[model samples]
Target: MGSVLAFFVLATVFFYNAGNWLVVSHLPQRADAIVVLMGGVPERIPEAVDLYKSGFAPRLIFPDDYEENPPEVLPDGSLLHNDAAKAMHLSSHFNIPDSVIVIVKGPALNTQVEAEIMAIYLADHPETDTIILVSSSYHMRRALIIFRNEFASKGLEITIISVPSRYTAFDPEKWWQTAGDRKTVFLEYIKIAYNLLWDRWF
Candidate 1:
């Protein structure tokens, strides 16, 4: 019993670092455009907006994730809440011009799909050589890798700068203390493993 408890404690200590392992952070630089990965809007969109406002990039790119669930319209004819809508609202609220925002018209149901869509978009616009990539703090590493691989596969030599969203409440040191964090970290590891095997097998 004592040995089992000791092993459990040891494992917990080592596993505590998984949250940090899943994260990647990089300082933003002047780029051709900023691509904010869909999902985690509350955290990611703001970061990308700030980067755009800071003159780090001239345009903001977002995948059209509204294909499956098109934006709803109220009786007042106003659009309901969605990532693209939310981003537009935030951009206007912050005094950013709508012209600088580019919505890549493609289905981006997952990170891999999003990467593929971005690659296709960039291929047509060879003038864009650098981009700032933004995602949730815990998702940045995987996203960066996927984007890099996708670009490489397409023979695109774009420079990618990874910047994790700063507004997330996830604390890497105590991720296991909360139910939300636990689920997020667990699913992330599972996704990492699945992507690894998927890449290897196919």
Candidate 2:
């Protein structure tokens, strides 16, 4: 029994590390737009900017995440909400022109809503057929699932690119070493399962 349990534990750890690599999809050379799904630490913006500067896309789309009654004044005296603040940072710090950076207007508080809003925008534009999605490394799997499911019938193609985040303590290589990383990975698996089942049945 002891040997059997040890073998199972070793197999689980091996799969966890190997699965992280499998979650990342191959990045395309170019796309119509680079859509940065907001929520992660500031790491996503820099990654998106790099992709944009590399000529991967002509435009950067940021979905305005919903915030209930945001504070009127930020620490810097800017009234911009979290999403808008990040957009401004992209423009000011990264030197991206406001014209090319589009802040998608709508109540997109989560990945599902963000995908829906992006679909509507693409439907109206018609010119943007492909998009490169920027998100955190651990989040890429679920994000791809949700976005692809949402845009399945819309004729829009999405490519996912993951950026390493400093905020998360989850180590992909040593995920089983810490309780936090284990919990994080466990929750992600649960969420992925939930999304799959929910989309299929409901």
Candidate 3:
């Protein structure tokens, strides 16, 4: 009974932090740019647009190596996924315009590589300070670790804005039992628990 009670107490703390990390929020009152992680889905693109509209960042940079799954299959050319395309679509819808939106396509195969590449871009253009990292709820914890590591030495003052939402996998409402939700939660549990206990991430 004691062990079970302890477990629940720990679980409550973990979920509270996770909930905070999942939702994207305003930065430290002075922000210059917003960068979105590219696993484009129903969640990220819209979140970025919403941030832009909210005046969180002056510019929105979508840095990615590959276009996600394109809406229509490509014949001989690489194309953008619905998520990526949605960024474009939302930009137009929100009247963000082309100037404030920077879409950098390199070889960002994963989060680490993407961070490295984004760091390089920001290095050259160092004027933009104070950033908001937009990502899914489950991804925020792990993603922030990578983002911090990659950007640590770069000298950019940044704040993370985790956008928690039920995206692309479907049935946003019934996440507790869904396979995707379960998988995400399991991963998140491992990530947060491990990090809290072990102080992982170098």
TM-score of each: 0.88, 0.82, 0.69
Colliding residue pairs in candidate 2: none
Better of 1 and 2 by lDDT: 1
How would the candidate models be sorted by TM-score, starting from the highest?
Answer: 1, 2, 3
lDDT of each: 0.85, 0.74, 0.64
Candidate 1 lDDT tens digits, 1-202: 9999999998887797888988888778899999988787778888888898789999998887754256757577877456766666666777878899998876677999999999999999999999999889989878887888889989999999999999877887789899999998999888888877877788
Clashing pairs in 1: none
lDDT tens digits by residue: candidate 2, 57-133: 89888888776476447577867557655655755678888888888887787888898898888878878777888
Model 1, backbone clash pairs (residues 3+ apart or across chains), number? 0
Residue 54, model 1: Cα distance from true site in angstroms: 1.5
List where candidate 1 sits over 4 angstroms from the true fold. Answer: 1-13, 68-76
Q: Ten consecutive residues with minimal summed lDDT in candidate 3?
A: 164-173
For candidate 3, write residues 3-90 as lDDT tens digits.
Answer: 9999999997765454344433334343677777777545776777776787777888877556544354556564546444556655
Q: For candidate 2, give the lDDT.
A: 0.74
| CA RMSD per model (angstroms) | 3.1, 3.3, 4.7
